[model samples]
Target: MVLILSAFLSSINQVFYAKWVQDIDPFVYSFLSFSITLLFFLSLTVLKSIKVKKSNIKLNNKITGMNSIVVLNIITAIIFICFYYANKYIEPAIVSAIEIGIGPIIALVLSLIIQKSNILKFDIYVCLGILIGTLILVWASLSGKSGIASDASFTYKGLLATFTAGIGMVLATIYSKKLSQAGWSTYEILAHRFYMLVPVTIVFVLNKKASYILDVFQSNWNWIILFTFLGLIIPLYLIQVGIKYCNPLFVSVTLTLGPVFTFVFQLLDPRVKWSWISLSGIGCLCVFVIIKMFIQNVGLNKEKPKGEKLKHA
Candidate 1:
């Protein structure tokens, strides 16, 4: 039940994140959102701070304590900028689909290259499914009543941007995993991730020649707070928590549903027609995921050793 709610909220989060990225500097926003959320979470720590069970502390205090976070900050700033721009030029649903759709494939390839994973038959099938689904989605998008030329017009640019963002995100995930394996607590990582963004955002916001930080104070704070809470704090925490419990690749696969959920919400919003091609592609991808999960679980069950049977003995 918790997982179900988490997944549902995670989907809605992609929508709110799309909206939030519009007005906020992605770097600063990422920073501020985490900073704010950290404070909120930290406040809970004050009331009920459970001591993190101490594990072997391999964290390189000199090299990783502050320095590593600093590097991640810079990398995340760049990622957010790319994401913001991509969302600006393309529909959020489509962009989300393309970015997350390719995550498992890219992650698998990178894992193999980095010696973090072994190539498997099912991985290939998953990759093929993702590719086919993506192509079908693109084709459907092009065939819309809006016309093929219109769909194809920004397709390449939009896809490239989203794809690049996905790569960045994958790299970030790998790095985070490495850091976590080295003994960084989730809070500590989140703190470092957000803390680094502070300065980056300041520079970006200044360079934009937009209103200064003080300008934000003059605007309505309600919606801003709402967006920050719903879009950033809540969802980010959920994702971080979710990844803690499940395979990262599976998390990426679950996120693919973001586009489907977004499309459903949008249809109710503006009365858009669903295209058969896209619907079928989504169905195929989902069916493939379910089948894969069932097979993997069955394999796991088969691998378990049976206890001695007293009656037979």
Candidate 2:
């Protein structure tokens, strides 16, 4: 239920982000959203007086000093920038769908090269299925009323931006897993990431027109309020809380449902047309996930650990 709720919030956030781009500067936009999230999360941690008593809360020895947090922040900032730009150029549903596949693939490839992890046969099957689904989605987008096939220039730019975001997301996920293992609180990770993002955003804004920010402050604050709450506070908090209790795989599969919600919202958006190919792709992935879960459950039951009896109702 947590994962499902988080996914739904994320889908809504996408729409809010689209509207947000118009009212504020992108760099300021990034800074404010992340800052809001950081403040909200940290406040919660303080109010609750959350401790490191739980194994999950303890920082890993590997993530000890500020150095690791610094590195993680750099990687995270890049990922956020890439994602925002991708959304600027492409459909939200397409970006979300492609990102689902990229994270696992990039992690797999990186582990093979650096960690010497062997890719199993089943891994290959999973990758192929994900790729097929994403390809169908893109094809569906192209076939629909969007003139993607006709306008060569816009098509190339949009596709490039979205695909780059996918690659960026993959890198970020790989780095984040390492950070998580290193003992940094999930809150700390996001905090450090926002710290990095804010300064970089300030520099970018200053380079363009530092004075524009004053205009931003003078402008109607309602959009910022809406954007901050919807895009930053709600989705981030929900996702973090959800992941805390859920199996990582289950969380990921639930997130794959994001595209489904994105499609539903897109139907109301006059800019894009609904595509059958993408819908079919999403359906196929859902089926694949259900089968995968069943297989995993069976394997776990068959190899139950000694001294631990399976409880029956």
Candidate 3:
């Protein structure tokens, strides 16, 4: 349920961005959204930690456990920086295919290497199917038959950045899962998730004319609010919750459902007029694969309970 909800929110996230982000400075827009999420999550955690303290909740995470979170934030910041760089050069369809399609495969390999787990033939096939499905969607988008339409030339620098973003996603998931295993509460995990948006901040600062940010706020506050809460924070919190319960590979595959969900949301817009027949058909097969993987993951994790729960979490 957590992963599904995360996927849904992620899909809808594009709608919020479409409504708001297009007009403003992308860097400023991202920074403001990050600022809002950070403040809300951090404040909530502080208050909850105070309340949780009086009740004698002795959560096991050492102060140093936050090291993983710090590392995660850095990686995430870099990933988005890479994504922005690549998106400018690569076709959006290719970008989507690379990042979304490649993420789970990275996770599977990471699991094999870091966890030294035995690989099942079935897992390989599912990952391949997902890759193929994503390629089909990208192909559709390129043909302008369905999905996102785009026109841009691919460059090696852009390709490198795309792979970086894709690989960074799996690495972040791994760290989140490691933190969960260390008994970190989901609230605490998220509370520090965006400690610093180093990449966005640097670019925003360098762009000078930073004063335009004030104008953006004055003009687009409502849209920014919607973008901050619904698009930025909620889906991320859900992803954290998912990491707390499910293995990285399961979470990775689950996140890929965004494309299908996005296609559904696009139908409501007259401009997009639903046309993902091929995408949806293959998406359903991918969904079945996801369900199978989820069932298997659940059975594997049945013995362990979530680390700690804040009423807020």
User: Candidate 3 residues 1-313, lDDT tens each?
Assistant: 7777876776676644543334555577767777788788889889987786532233445455778978988888877667666555444434444666677788778767777765556666777777776566545544556533435344556667877888898888889888878777787777777766745565665765757778787788887888677766888888888888777777777777665665556556444545554455447446745665665756533222368321100
For model 1, the run of ten residues with the poorest summed lDDT = 304-313
Please rank every candidate by TM-score, starting with the best: 3, 2, 1
The Cα error of candidate 1 at residue 79, in Å, is 3.0
Query: How far out, in Å, is residue 29 in model 3?
Result: 0.6
Measure candidate 2: CA RMSD: 5.1
Model 2: residue 241 alpha-carbon error in angstroms: 5.2
User: How does model 2 fare in lDDT?
Assistant: 0.60
lDDT of each: 0.58, 0.60, 0.66
TM-score, predicted candidate 2 vs. hidden true structure:
0.75
Name the lDDT value of residue 265 in candidate 3: 64
Candidate 1: C-alpha RMSD to true structure equals 6.0
Error of 3 at 276 (Å): 5.2
Q: Which of 1 and 2 is the better model by TM-score?
A: 2
Q: Which of the two candidates, 2 or 3, achieves a greater lDDT against the reference?
A: 3
- Flag the better candidate by lDDT, 1 or 2: 2
Q: Determine the backbone clash count of candidate 3.
A: 0
